[model samples]
Structure formats: structure tokens, C-alpha cells
Target: DALYVGNALSYRAMAYMDLARMFEFKRTGVAYLDEEAANRGIYGLTVPIVTENTTERESRDNPRAPFYKMYRFIMDDLNLAEACLSDAHAVSAKTDASIGVVYGLKARLWLDMGSRFERYVDDLNTMISHEADEDLNDYDKIGITTANECFARAAEYARKAINEGYSPLSESQWFDPSIGFNTPNNSWLWANIISTNDIAATTGEWQSFVSFQCVEANWGIAVYQDEINYAHGWMIDARLFDKIDEGDWRKTTWIDPEDAGASNAFITKYSRGTNLSYNEWRNYRSYVGIKYHPANGERNTSTIGNAVSIPLMRIEEMFLIEAEATAHTSGVGAGKQLLESFMNTYRMSAGESYTCKAADMEAFTDELFKQKRVEFWGEGIVYWDYRRLELPIERGYPGSNHARQYRFNSYPEHVAPWTNFYIPDRERDLNKGVILNPDPSQAIPLWEGGN
Candidate 1:
């Protein structure tokens, strides 16, 4: 019971921290919003970590607290959970806090805390210590970075988790549209199902917007409507699609207008097959991908749309994280070598090979970042890295159609405006503690280890 409560609280703390990172200015205890840059109707602002009053309203109305206070709240919840949970790897699923899950969550939280990210090295080691197979690289290079003096221990923990039978799917497996949404694979670690008989069960969508993101054409039509509006209009940014090489299996994730039989069109893994009527498929053109479980498909009945599982965390992420950690802590050579090995094993190419190398460490870091963005595009992991690094994204890059209205072009260079959201006026009026972020366009430096 204590473990359960602690885990739940940990989740709440994470959600709060996520919002703060998104909306709050790094140096100031406020969300970024210059009066000249204000936009309305956004809420879900950051909360105070230190509490003087226990009442709901006071907490809601209070201004954003110091970073230390917020970090304390996050740590307290996670620490308590760790104390309550056993290290026996009990309850892999939902019955109780599995030791592995706790460790993984702590590692992620510590990384977010920046100064404490190295703490993950320890938790990862704890998890790795329990592995049945001591050989971290024995099974196709799935978990942890390459073994070396700096990251060997962390690699051990990663190897243990990978030994638990998690890995990335082969390119051919990913290319198969049928059974794409099926679960209990060699790769996926944690997953949750989108049940039918729920709002997310609507034929054209899932609760997480997978249907919206990965589906297009008649395949994505409303479960009830044989033909209707496009589902939610979500898609991969065109510039992101450009990064994939022609020979790479992931290139199938998007389609060029010419190949798609029209301008701005492409094929995606969202379909069960290319067996659809030409007219039916034309509507989708180039706007679909696989992560959204579109292959789970539209149903004849609205009562139950696509029944599919969402991959919450995959070992692939750990692989990438290890590569990055190795690069930063161990050195570029160790990081590069580990990343290259992983790519050669899992992300091999048919026509085009993956390429990223740098003469300088900073340039090498850039290469690593590029690989990460490509590898985890639809998985929803890259944006946080951009925020943490204060990296600028080029929405106006060649082949991009990102709308200008949502972009902040006030400064010398244009900036992505969607990076931060605004706090609704109601938040300021109703909650005395709220302050609107004036400029969501400009990047905020890391609160720690940055000037």
C-alpha cells in the first residue's frame, strides 16, 4: 500500500515538474511570457513545491516555488516509494511497484533534476546486478551503452534489463503492417492498452491520439462515418520526415507527394496493408505513421474502435540514453562507439546507411542529438531533450509546412512558439499565485549548470 501511494505521488510530482519545465522561465520563478508576446486560453501552469497552507486553493493560487523546493517534492515521493518497495523485482505489472520500474523512474527523475542525473548510474547498476545474462552485448545490442570503464557498471544494469527479454523490433518486422499493434514482443518493456467501449474507442482515434497521429485516408474515417472529416489532423512534420534516408526502413513512415500520387502525400505504416481502394487511400496521401496503433484499425462500430497497446517505455530508449550518458560522462569515443554498435545491430540499412560523426566533441554531440531525434521521432522522447539542452529547432527548414501564425518571429531569428504554453487569464484571476509566461518562443537555459 505504501509503495502504491508513493508511486502515485511520484507520478503527480513528475507531472508538475514537466509542466514547470515547459512553462516556467528558468532563472525566474515564473512562466515565460513577455507582455508583447502574450496569448490567451492556456492553463495547466506550474505549482509551488513548498507548501505553507494545506488548502487546495492556496496551493493553486501560490506562485511558482524555487527549483529546490520543487525538486524536494519530487525526490521525497520517489524516495518514499523506494523505501516501501522490495528489491525482489516483485509485481512486474500493476499489482505493486516492481523494483525495476522504481529504479527506471528514479533514473529518469534524477536526469531531469540535472545535477543529480548521475544517480541513475547507481539505480541502473542496481537493476543490472540482477541480470541473468552477464553479457550485455550478447543479444543484438539492445540495452545499455557499450561496456567500458566509465559506463560498464551502468551497462551491466542495462544488460540485466535487456536480459529480461526486451529489444527493438527488426526492420522487416516493423515494415509488416499486419499485427503491428500486437504486444508482448521481444522489445517492448512497459505498455498499456487502449480499451474499446471508451471515448478513445472511437474508430478514428485512441485516448493518446495514436489514431490521430498515425492514421489517414478511409482508414482513419470516423468509425461511424464511412467518410467524414480527417481525424484530428495530426502528422509528422515534413522536415522531420526529410531526415530519413531513402533506403532506411523508417523511410516508409512518410511519403513524398510525387510517390504518393499527389503533392504532399506519402504512405505510412498506419494501414493494415496497401489493399485499400485507391480512392479510399488517396485521402490519407502522405499523413500517417505507426506509433499511433493505426494498424489496430478502425472498427465497424463506435462502441469499440482500435484495441491496441501503447508502448510507454521501450528498451530502445534506454539504449539511446546509455549512448548519450556514455558520451557525456565517459567521452565522445565511448559514446560514439556504443551508439554505432547499437545502430549496426538493430537499425541496419538496405539502400542507405545511418551516418553521424564529428571531428569535435560539440559536433559529435550534435550528431548524437540528430540520431536521437530520428530514432525516437514518433515515440515522444526528443522534445524534452531539446528543452533541457535549450536547443533551437528549425520549423522553417526546407520542406516544412509549419504554420507561421503559431511561430514567434519577433526576434532576429524565428523561434518555435509551441515549445511553451500560456497560462490562461483565469489562472491569473482565480489563482493569485499565477503569472503568465510572456514569451514561449525563446528558449530558457537549464536552471542548473548553465549561466
Candidate 2:
């Protein structure tokens, strides 16, 4: 198979996993608190798996597959991908589905499957490899499973990344000033460039979505002295600004709404300052997402247009994955150390460092997810993190200032959502076995008596 086969398999597997997450209930096997609660999770696995080539009519008429059957299909494709992709290929303008990415995908999939499966730990080990080429002079390999070993391996992988001359464009890589999320650095393993050629407004990528969510309507910096057609419609939640910890360099990237005398806090990642030439200043939309910054350099991509790379997998995520898996398997202490090291190195400002030992497993996991949300905000993958755990869809505590659409209403104000998008009607019609999932509550968004 061509290297691309691995990439396609990876993408297909991801699609199924995401659908499974939306349609199936949390799989930690804790036993849903109640039958109603279980129903809210779509306790029945109704989505189908078609292994053979079939038409929409045939596919629609096919029966829904069991949960394991679907995952087994995904794993099958991934295992094949692992065998096909190279041990590691240096990243380029177009990142290949390298063996490392294969491993990273496996780690994520296994984590979604939860504690019953331990194979993902070994998968991570293999992907990082022989201590992830740790010895600057030595190519010997080692396997790790326990927390301590995992921690050491994770650390070494990060270390090897540096030793191999993989430096952040600067110390501010997290809220990267130069690339923000646009630049692919040594830290990036797989990144997909979205040229204006790739831009789709009706069904757009991160750039379009951010333009809708982060930018104010008609907020394009047209007053500036350059030509680029861009606009904004939404803004970042002020509460999210309140969440950034002091001394964390990322906190400085946004203009606080209060200080700015505005109702919403806005991120600098996309805001082109007022009265600045769009060509010289490079800020296009005050409410636009900078993840795929506008690049006029590409042919036909004029000043502040979308011609930037979208990061899919980065070394930063690998560090967190190892830390999380280590905590789950080895113990909180090992995992905690790895996480603290990452924050100290990648997240903190000059002369500022933060460290913690989890009082318990839950505490440690909490910290890991928190770091994930902040670090990966606007990347559009954090929703899966919450869904995998079957956690509530909470924006803020009761009576908080979060916008209404951002906040869900339930008894106690935090339970299942009243609304969830179902499989599109077209899919249901084309795929005969497909059925619609119901809201957790018929009358309200939360379960009966749920708060």
C-alpha cells in the first residue's frame, strides 16, 4: 500500500471513533447511574460498520454493528498502518502519516477505550521508540510500561526532540507569536496546510469556524491600509480568560474585556490592530482564529488570506499523552512529574515555574485535562476529550457570566444536554438501519431529578 493508505486509514478510523463517541455512552463501564441516564448516552449501539464496498442503498439497509465490531475495524486499519509507515520521517511542508503519528493515534484510541485495554501503552512505547532515539550517540531501543519507565521514556522523547535541534520558533511556542498555531516547528509531527485553495465557507475548516466564532461581525480591519476581505461574528468567553493561571505566558495573549472596556475578552492570535496596513500588520480579523493565519505569500493568497498550516499532531501533545498514560498506569507521582516538567519548560514565563503532585488520581487527571483545554483551545478537538469521559457539558458554574449559547441548562445546571445533534437526516435515509438519537430530556435538557 502507498504511504497514503496509512493516512486514509487513520482518517477513516478517526471518523468512526468520533461517531461512536457521539452515539455511544461512556465506556468506562462504571454502570450508568440509572436507566434514564444510560438512555441519555444512547445506550444502544445502533451505528453500522460496512467492511465491503457498498452503495448508499445497500449501506443504509445494512444492520448496525456492535461497538466492539466497529472498534475492531478501526484497530485493524491502524495495525496495518503501523506496519506500513516508516519508523519516523522528518516532518515537511506536508507531514506524512509517519509511524509516530500511527502510534499517537493508537494512544488516543486506546485512551478513549479506557482501562480495560493496556495495549495502547505498548503502542506509545513503540512509537516513541528505543527510547525515542534518546542517546544522541546511541540508537539502542528500550521498552517501557510502568509509570516510572513511561515517564523516563516520555522525558527522553522530549529531550531527543531538543537534542536533535528541534527548537520552538521561540520560547513563546505555546502562544507562538510568530506562527501561533500556523507555523510547523520541530514540535509538529503532522500538519496540513490550508491554502485559500482549501478554504470552504459553507463547510469550512478551523479558519472559517473561528471567523464565525471569534471575530465580531464585519469586524475586519478594513480601516487599515491594505486589501483583504475578512469578517468576525463571535468572541472568546470572558470566563475562559479568568481561567488562565498567573505566570502562564499564554494569559498575556488576550486583551481582558474589562481592561479593554468591552463585554468580551478577545485573543490576539487573530486580531489585526486598528489603522495598521493589512499587508504590514498581518492582522486580518479581530475575531478571526489565528490558528491558520492569513498568508499572502502563496500564489493567489493575498494579504491576510488563509494560506497557513493547520497543526494536527504536535510534540506538545505527545508529552501530555505520555504524562496522562503514565499517571493512569504507573501512578500519579510519575505522571505528575512529567506534567510539571512540561509546564515548566513549555508553558511558564521567565523565572516562573509550577509543579504539583496529585493528591489522588482524579486530581492528577484533572490537571492534565485542564492543561489540554488551554493548550489546544481553538484547535477543535477538546470536545472529544470531554465526551470520552462522559463528562457533563459545562461552560461555567451556575450563575456564571458565560454567554447563554455557551451555557447549557439542566437541573443543578450541569447534567446531560437538552440538545444533541443527531446523525444527519440524509444519512438516516440513505442508511436504512440508521435511527435518530433522542435528547436526554424530553421536556428539559437534564435527566429527571438531575442537577
Candidate 3:
């Protein structure tokens, strides 16, 4: 129970830290914006001026907590959790806290925090080196020092989890074809494994929320089928797709064979069997499975078998974070060297030659973005990456861009100036009419207008 709670808290912290790094302006001592520059829009809009009390009421509070505060809170919680779990002894004869789960979690949290706060690079390096030495486990510790060291670390941790008897579902273990929906592999770290009967028994609420079918059924909520297509396609950035080459295994694992006749050719990472009922198969809920259980009336029931062990902190992400931070701190050349080394490890593991050169930082940064996107797709890291890099959110289908634009617009009103959102009316009333209405020109307009 303690370990689970610790892991959960650590995951939350890791997420917040990532956001903090992405949104907060680096404290460069001098403010970059001057009155003239500000008029020219050269310095970019001032970060939205927000105080602790008013921050919560700003337009950007959808996920809850302002960006800066969220990071601080996450860091505090993660630090506390790490401290609590640091000395925890492992109970399994083969696995203990020192050698097993705790170390991986710690290494992950440290690297995540360290990555965002460049000052913590050394601390992260120390943690990685320490964990690699202590745990000879693969998934938890993959490549010691290689070109793809970061990716290797991630792979290593995943490999360790698997090798340590973390079972992924096998073909035979999948549900019967006639029953619809294949049984999830036992190897899942955590998953929302939904049975067909579970869907039929419910009032389609479970199927609607969790399945892609929600797009069609929940059109009133602004959800639609094209939304899924947009999400899948939007995730396919050029940099990441290019890295896969023609026949990489990772690509094969997620990308489906093209169906020329279908409106959308590409499939998704999660595959529902053909035999599954349309209502169950077509919906995201069916694909991801329901988050709640009918029996206990509790959400995220571990017993109902839908609890997917989503890898919150893995060695690969740390490796990338370390590489990026190291490169930023060190010269770009030095960072490229680290990145190349890590990539080579990935190549070797896949029986391919590590072909990247460490000569160009720009190219290397591009590669880093690519690898991170592909490796962490569907794990909820892309949104943060887009924010940190200040990359525009573009989706091919309709409503996708609107959703992202809404998020971006909310940022300025709720947190910082770079964020965009209309000033709240309540604030106008409370602050003696000091609230400034958001400028329409400042909104990071969506990529598409309509579906």
C-alpha cells in the first residue's frame, strides 16, 4: 500500500515538474520584454500576471492548479514520497525496495525533476549511475552508457519489469474471438482490461466514456468519431515518424496496415479485435476499457482488471531528460555525443546499426524530440512536450485544434502572459475593474476550423 501510494504521488510530481519546466520563463535575472519591444510583440506577451489567490479562478484551471504552483506542488510531493520510500526494504525474497520497485521509482522521479531544473543535472546523473550499479535488472536498468543511453535506460526499466516476471498478455490468453475483445496480456504493468459482458451489462456509459464509440454517441458533449482520427494522426509528427525508418519493429508494433478503402488508413496503438461488437469495438472505452467497476461502484478498481500499470517513471524518459539537460548544460556537441550513444544502443537492441552523427545540435535535438514522442506516445507526454517547446498544436481533423487552442488560450488568463484566455468577469468585479480583457490576436489559433 505504501509503495503504491508512493508511486502514485511520484507520478503526479513528475507530471507537474514537466509542466513547470515547459511553462515558466527561465529566471534570466533581467526581464526580456521592454516597453518598445512589448509593443512590437518581440518579447512575446508578458507571462500572465497571477497571484496565488487569483490563480485558481483564472480560465486555465481545467486540470486544476496553475502551472508554476503545480510544479512546486509536484516536486514537494515527489520529494516526500521518495523520502518515505527510500529506506523501504523489499519484501519479496528476490526483490526488495533497495533492489526493486523503489529504486526504479526514485531514479525516475530524480531524473524527471532534474531534467526540468537544469541545476539538478548532476543529481540526476548520480541517481542514474547509482541505480544502474545497484539493480542489475534490465527494464529498470538497460544501457549503462551508450549512444541511446537514455532510451536504453527506458527500455532497460521496461525490460526489467518484464524479466522480473511482469507478464504481457499472450495471444492465447486473449479473449475468445467469438466473445469479442481479446484478453489483455498479463504483461501489462497496469491496464483497464474490459470484458465484452461488462459493456453489454452497462447502460453504454462505460462504453461511451472509455471507448472510441463515445465520439459518436457523445456528440452532444462535442465528442465525435473524427476526434479519434485527429488524435491518432496528430500524434504522428514528421520527426518521430522519420526516425522509424521503413521497417522498424516499434513502428510495426503500433501502426496498422493501411486500408485504402477506409476514410482513415492508419490504425491506432490499441487494437480491438474484429469480432468485438461495433458499440464495444468502435469506442475508446472499449479499446482502453472502463475506468470504473460495476461490482464495487468505485472508479479505477484494481480488482476489476482495468487498472493498467501505465509506466509513470521509466529509465528511457530519464535517459532522454539527462541527455537533454546534459546537452543544455554542457556544449551542444557534448550533448549530441550522449544522444548518439543512446541511439546506438537502441539500434543494437533492434539488430540495426546506430547511424546518427553527433556533429549537429539542431539535428540531435530534433532526434531527441522524435524518439521521445514515439517512445512515449499515448502515455500523455506529447501535450507537455508541445507546451515546453512552444510548438503549435496542429491536428488534421476538426475540433482537435479547437481543443488545443482552448487549452492554450486558458494558459494566459489562468497562469502566465504567454498563455491566452479572456479575462474573467468575476475578477473584473473584484479587482476594482483592473482585469484586462484578452486580445483575440494573441490566441494561438487552431490548425483547423471545422470537421
TM-score of each: 0.69, 0.70, 0.47
Q: Give the TM-score of candidate 2.
A: 0.70
lDDT of 1 by residue, 1-451 (tens): 6666655654555566676666644222223443233343223224555433358767666776434344445556655665665453444553233444455555454445432233235534533443334432222211332123324444434544455446687875565544453343556655655566545655434333444444432334321133455533445666666655565566565544455544233233324333334454455545344433343444233333355565655677667666765666568887788777777778767544555566556777577777677667666677676655556665443344555433322222222345566667777776787667655434433222211
Candidate number of the best lDDT: 2
Clashes of 1: 16
What is candidate 2's lDDT per residue for 120-197, written digit by digit as tens?
454343334433433212211223344344444444443433343343323445443335565566766667765555
lDDT of 3 by residue, 1-451 (tens): 7666665665554444553444333221112322333443322221233333455555343222333233334445645665666554333322113223433443343344333333334433443454434322321332133233443343344334334343322232222222112122222232233443554324444343223321222222213344454222122333344456553334432233232122232233223322223343333221121111122222223233222123333345545655665565466676666666666554233456555454565566666777777666555655555444434333334333223444332221122334323345665455442323333344343343454
lDDT (CA) per prediction: 0.51, 0.52, 0.39
Candidate 2 Cα lDDT to native: 0.52
Displacement of the residue 318 alpha carbon in candidate 1, Å: 1.4
